[model samples]
Target: MRIVDVCAFYTPHGGGVRTYVEQKLRIGPQLGHEIVILAPGDEDGVVERGPNARIVTLKSPRFPLDRKYGYFASAEQLHGALDALAPDFVEATSPWRSAGLVADWAGAAPRSLVMHADPLSAFAYRWFGQVFSRRTIDWQFSVYWEHLRRHSRRFDHVVCANSDLSRRLAEGGVPRTVTLPMGVEPGRFSPLNRDPALRARLLAACDLPESASLLLGCGRLSPEKRWPMVIDAVNAAGQQSPIGLVMFGEGRERRTILKHIAGNPHVRLFEPERDRETFARILASPDGLIHGCEAETYCMAAAEARASGTPVIVPDGGGAADHAGDGAGMTYAACDPAAAARAIATVLRSPRRQPQEARTITQHFAELFALYEDTRARVRMAA
Candidate 1:
């Protein structure tokens, strides 16, 4: 089978989306499938992965807010590209204007809208939360949800990354939404990777001693992530126990998050881990993973942490909660620093939970391709 993914948010230096797509391209051949990506780039070119997988880059304008990414202006190029690829299955990972472009394409392939992020929860609520009440924000979100429903109906299927999005879509009368949980890389992170020396080093970086609990926070430092709340929770926990937090990632909210952690000697900020192996080892060494974001779509970092046999403390809501699974973690009420602090202390004091079973990248590809094959057969029968 041949599959083509049209993604507008995928940049040269993107985070989870990029990682997911690259893994698919790299692993598709093992399942006897061909995959290609149609994405916005600085210049039009083809980046070859192997004989059957590659990325087709189309020149497009830069995303103003973050120049690292680009946005699709029109469907003309994408429409032409889809016609050329003539894939058996097509996927639009972007929910922006590109969604409409994919919807308008007159292609024979069965298409799906791979909902990677929740606009209402991740953007609308976070951006307007201060100005509007929860009820008001949800009511206003109905407008955006309605807009999505229109375009989503154009595709054969709508797949969500987590249960939070699936429930939201179901509540909005889009019951066909399927929840396809993403997988973490196998072998890259494991219980065996835990290093005592590395754990001590991380604790020392936070000005903590050997007895301190080293908690890991990995994600973009942004307002939506609520890093300030995380720092406050860690500080509050530090008052009662030997706990420290070492955050890994950089973003626009760096200054704000840094200021929030300035008075707390137990919290330290670090840049994102560039090397996957080293990152995985460090992840395994942490006593636990503490997350503050309540609007995550898939929470890949938390999944990686769990795969590393590190317990995770996430909000009771959102995709992160789902990633925490049944055994490797616990959840606190959303946006409550005291609750989060208490949860953190509890997790740090308890014995580490064994790593739960996680879907591997190969397994994700196999399941996704089977879905595509089924969707394609249905489309053919309908036609």
Candidate 2:
């Protein structure tokens, strides 16, 4: 089958969505499918060419907030690209402008709407947290809900990477919602990858001795990620014993995170590790991975942490909690810094979970590919 993914959130310097798309490109061919991606770029043309997979860049304008990202302007160009690809199936991976365009597509192949992020919790709560109650913010988010609810009807399937988002969309009246968890490369990140030297260096960077409990935080340093809350929790936990935190990742919250961790020798912010093996070793070395986001869809960071045999500390809701798994880590009340601190202390006091082998990426690929086939078959039968 030939599958085309229209992703507005993919860029050379983007986050999880970019990684997900790239991973799909690598796996699609192994599953005997051709995968093409249509993404926004400064230059309009095919940048990556391969027999089974390729990325087609559509000329678009730079996003004002961050020039690293591009915004789609002409829907006609997108439609033209889709028409040319003539894929067996189409998947719209973002809820922004591209989604509406893909939903209204009058094409031969079936379409699927992949919900990669939650707009209400990721954006609204982060944007209006100071001005309105969550209930009020959620009420305002209904506008977005209605937008998706209407567009989702046009697609053959609505797919979510976690059950939380799937249940929310299903409850909100979106049809054919499905939960499909993403997978991690267990070989890249395992307990055996743990490096005592790297752990020592990380501890030293945070100005802590080897005796101090080292907590690792990974992901975008954005407001929705709630890194500040994690920093506060670490500081609170520091009062009890020697605890240090090293956060990896960059985002709009860099300055804010720096300010939050200022004057605390035990907390430091570091740029994301580019080397995969080194990063996995870092994950394996940490006493635990602490996550603050409650609106997470499928936290690849937490999943990778678990794959590295590192225990995770996450909020009690959202995808992170689901990835933490029973006996894999600890969970605190959602968005509660105090509770998170206690959870951190508990994890440090308790013996670490024995590193277990993680399911391979092939498993996730097979499951998602089956969904595509099933959707296509159902569409043909209905036709």
lDDT of 2 by residue, 23-118 (tens): 888888989989898899999888565679999999999989888888778888888888988999999988878999997777889888888888
What is the total number of backbone clashes in candidate 2? Answer: 0
lDDT of every predicted structure (CA atoms) = 0.85, 0.86
Cα RMSD of all models vs. native, in order, equals 1.5, 1.7
Model 1 stretches with alpha carbons more than 4 Å out: 130-135
Predicted candidate 1: what Cα RMSD to the true structure?
1.5
156-275 in candidate 1: lDDT tens per residue? 878887888888788777646888888889778898899999999888887889897889999987777888898888888888878888899988898988887876777888899899
| Top-scoring candidate (TM-score) | 1
In order of appearance, the predictions have TM-scores of: 0.96, 0.95
Considering only N, C-alpha and C atoms within 3 Å, which residue pairs clash in candidate 2? none
